[model samples]
Target: SSPLPTTVFEDEATAAQKAIDALKAQGIQRIVLLSHIGYSNDKSIAAKLTDVDVIVGGDSHTLLGDFSAYGITSSGSYPTMAKNKDGDTVCIVQASEYSKAMGELTVNFNAKQSVDSCSGKEHLLLGETFTRKDAAGKTVTLAGADLDEVKAIIAKDAQLWSLKPDASAEAVLQGYAGKVDALKKEVIGTASDLLCLERIPGMGYSKTPGCAEATRAHGGDISNLVAFAFRDMSITSEIAIQNAGGVRIDVPAGDVTIGTAYTLLPFANSLFELDMTGTEIKAVLEEAVEYAVKSGGSTGAYPYAAGLRWTVDLSKPAGSRFSNLEFKGKKDSAWTPLDMGRTYKVVTNSFLAVTGGDGYVTFKKVNDAGRGLDTYLDYAQSFVDYTKKTKVLNRLPVSEYSTQAIYDKNGLLQQ
Candidate 1:
């Protein structure tokens, strides 16, 4: 008999102004609106709204500080200034993402309750410097002054943190800690062999653990396991391909625990299904191999499919890289040549299948065309479910996969 509350609004500006008016009606003179709609949206809001004095914004993960000496790029200056509708200044600031820095702003108001001057610094947070590789995998040293400032901040934080602990919160955390300790030791699955997940730096290929034989195995043992888990969880798709980078680490031979699975496949990528034609599938593989060849075999676009296999010749040109493609619907089914005209139901992680992650452009295109469907299954949970259902995990050796070779100039297989 009653209409629903106006809880869901269409426009962000309308919702924001409504809240601003409500607060102003309550005798609030100055407003510092904290927002996550990103830097550009903050500017738009400040331009239209004269009531807001300051906006601390985020979500774009824009770095607004001078971090060049510390090897960080800044999008703009800290405390970026904006002009409001009433010709007043509105201060907007955003700290960078990944908890790497803190933005501090101080404002001084004039006699008329307007900000006279504002200044702040984005403090670069750091930990004890260790020998670490840069993004290009080159060894680099942290700046001495930055390192010293980090150490000082660490010491000061330690002193402040040691001053007091909330008794109730500490007790709650301790109870959770005890449960976590037990969960860490609880065995969830068992592995009979060591899964070699050693990947060549910049190259997606990997070698068997403690063995000399190397292969361009995109999924490797661990990633194959993850892909298999995706296929097992999907109701409409028989094939599952996960990005090689999604598999984080190697799983050792022993009992598998909750912690073990978490370390191996940590990210919360959801499973997505795609209704794709075999022609598009071939194109996706070609893009991956082309990326690898173009990047000197340094890309993670390599595919690791659960129900499909194909041959890749690195010596060949881009579109001709893949051949002898086959798909097996069931574990006991015979492998059949993939029909280029037939549409197949495929499954992959949300990152690669939906966002074209790791250069899966074909998948993203199909998804954007409304052919992709979200299964809403968490990747790690699928692995957990597979482990529980199967009860045993085994290392998939190179012998288990279809033949893959690199051709030399003379059309001969290279060693």
Candidate 2:
């Protein structure tokens, strides 16, 4: 919404020059620039670039399904394309962002008006409502009904819009639907009645979510599932980390599709492992906690862990947010500080691996860190491999994940 540089548009002058160049070459009377430029910029470009006929743009994601009613030019500039002092054909169209609807207009070219005519004309008036006045000055509803006729007629037929390259068009096209029957079918994953989705239940010992529990049960069960599936690369004996933001979609507990996994991890991120010490791990844990709270918490509610678990004290400084970090290798052993010098294998998504995401910058110093690998196939393959071997994940509790540290002579450990 902010008026910043757009990914789609470079500059209006350059864009307009391109339009003019195209017209001179083809000897075309009209040109259009469908754009995502905000309403104001669209007018400025249209006014400066006089050679174009129409612009069917996209960016602001405005809904032209109703069609725009009117376009105002700069105070000194001429009207729009459709009407010039010389009355030429010009139009602009755009449907709002997202996939709700669109608008269109049909023009019957008249042979009388010379094609070169450019005067006080307004190009497009494709709003939800347009009125005409009568002898008594009563308003005229040129098109009847809001949702019924005019809107669809114009959205599908007319030619008035700015440039919206990536925005989806409402052209009538077939959409394929699948897995209709598969939804009701039984999934063959390991069935456990104790599978819990809540983090801290009101009952006795809170049972974690299956997905979370699975990651804890087998560090990197979630991240490594995909990491090891890649050719010549597998997560081995490391603390695999998954930031909450990356898992965009929740895995459905049913017959899953190859597409489902793709949707769950849509971002194009590679998998790479890091050899970090427990000191670095502590820094990341605290950072993750702080990042979670800063991002409205809900998105970060599900903290990730592979070979370790750390709790945070919200009152502490953000970088050192976590007050406790420990690893678990045996039962009856209390959690302890991680060794600073010891290196721990770490696998994470490429976003954080290079960019120092989630405030883990220590790894940024390790440039020759990881082998770039596609994790999508690895993820799909992991599920496939799991189903073949066993459905049940047998996820262990988060309590099993603790940092490693040796106590003093008295065997008393330090945080």
Candidate 3:
């Protein structure tokens, strides 16, 4: 591709500043910036931009205001105030994630188009709680309740769902719902053994051990299987890597259904291949290990690769966390240290290969340099293909991973 066009996308703060400057130049004061850059960035902009009066932001999924009445935790105060470089006041606010609450911020601007005073509250919308039979066959009432009078008032709201459904919309939803239900019960394949959904503790953020803990110490069964599937489908890939977060669930020791496959790899990310040297691959692994350590054992960034293996030492600093790196060209081949100078064909999800989701910035750099190829292969489908080919998924293979005494007996990192 003629060295993919270099288009520099500005970060949120820079882009917001550009827009604010433009508006100020146009004599537009009392500007309310609707931002999705997140709460922290909003505060940064408030501290930096003198012209912005208020910022309604999202993306950190931050909860603001005193939601204690509703039993929700507020991350920070509502309408957080900050002074700009010129000492002008700016107001910042954000609603929590997934529309669970709506923020109502009232901003009063002074004559100079700066915030004078502000007050706001987050309104939490909850479902109508009702009484139900307990496991002991006793009737019990849920703590939160919606009175009949309140229900009557809400019934008058045109936006609320009606007891009488719309004929056309209901028909469409019913058709799709039926199809979904059928697919959930449809068998795709089978497994000879159970794939534990519980995360391997001690290795990830948790410290509790599970049946699959050993496998996940290096790479879990689902992740390894997914990586193998990607390589199998690719034309130029000699190895494949999958992120732990991408593999969402486990396959039980029974028939593997379509639902099972979908649950295993829920993301829509496609397969991507790239030419990366052994050195770059090692760096990628190091990044993953460091991320796990820094995140207190978060598995999201942990890398699981087919035809690749390595050990991690939490005692080591960031760049040196990974060691004993090895790779194999085929299943029956002997393992060998990664050749730092040799470019190897590697396969990974498009999310990591292109945008570097979950902090795989090294891969993103390679993709930006036009060295990566977008195979456009559906990731979840790759799992399905592997299931059909293997026919039965037995227990996960023993891991080649190793880690030092990262924590002391008191559950703290050993110094």
> For this target, which candidate reaches the highest lDDT against the unseen true structure?
1
Question: Which runs in model 2 stand beyond 4 Å of their true positions?
Answer: 1-31, 34-53, 64-92, 105-176, 179-188, 198-233, 245-283, 295-298, 326-345, 350-384, 401-415
Model 1, TM vs. native: 0.74
Q: After superposition, how far is residue 177 of candidate 3 from its true place, in Å?
A: 4.6
Prediction-by-prediction clash tally: 0, 67, 2
Candidate 2: minimum summed lDDT over ten consecutive residues — where? 197-206
Q: Which candidate do you rate higher for TM-score, 2 or 3?
A: 3
Q: How does candidate 3 score on lDDT? A: 0.71
Off by over 4 Å in 1: 1-29, 37-51, 60-78, 96-114, 119-171, 198-219, 292-298, 397-403, 406-415
Candidates' TM-scores? 0.74, 0.51, 0.68
Q: Is candidate 1 or candidate 2 better by lDDT?
A: 1
Model 1, residue 183: C-alpha shift (Å): 2.1
Model 1: clashing residue pairs? none
TM-score, ranked from best to worst:
1, 3, 2
Candidate 1 lDDT over 1-415, as tens digits, reads 1111333545766777788899989988788889989998988988887677889999999888766665667888888998777778788999888976778899887776667777887765554563557899998876687566655655654211112356899999999999988987778889888775633222434444442243333335676677777888897787787666677776778998888877888887889899999999899878865665465553556677777877767667778877889887856457888899999999998888766867788988998788888877888878888898888898664533533444543565544
The local lDDT score (0 to 100) that residue 341 gets in candidate 1 is: 99
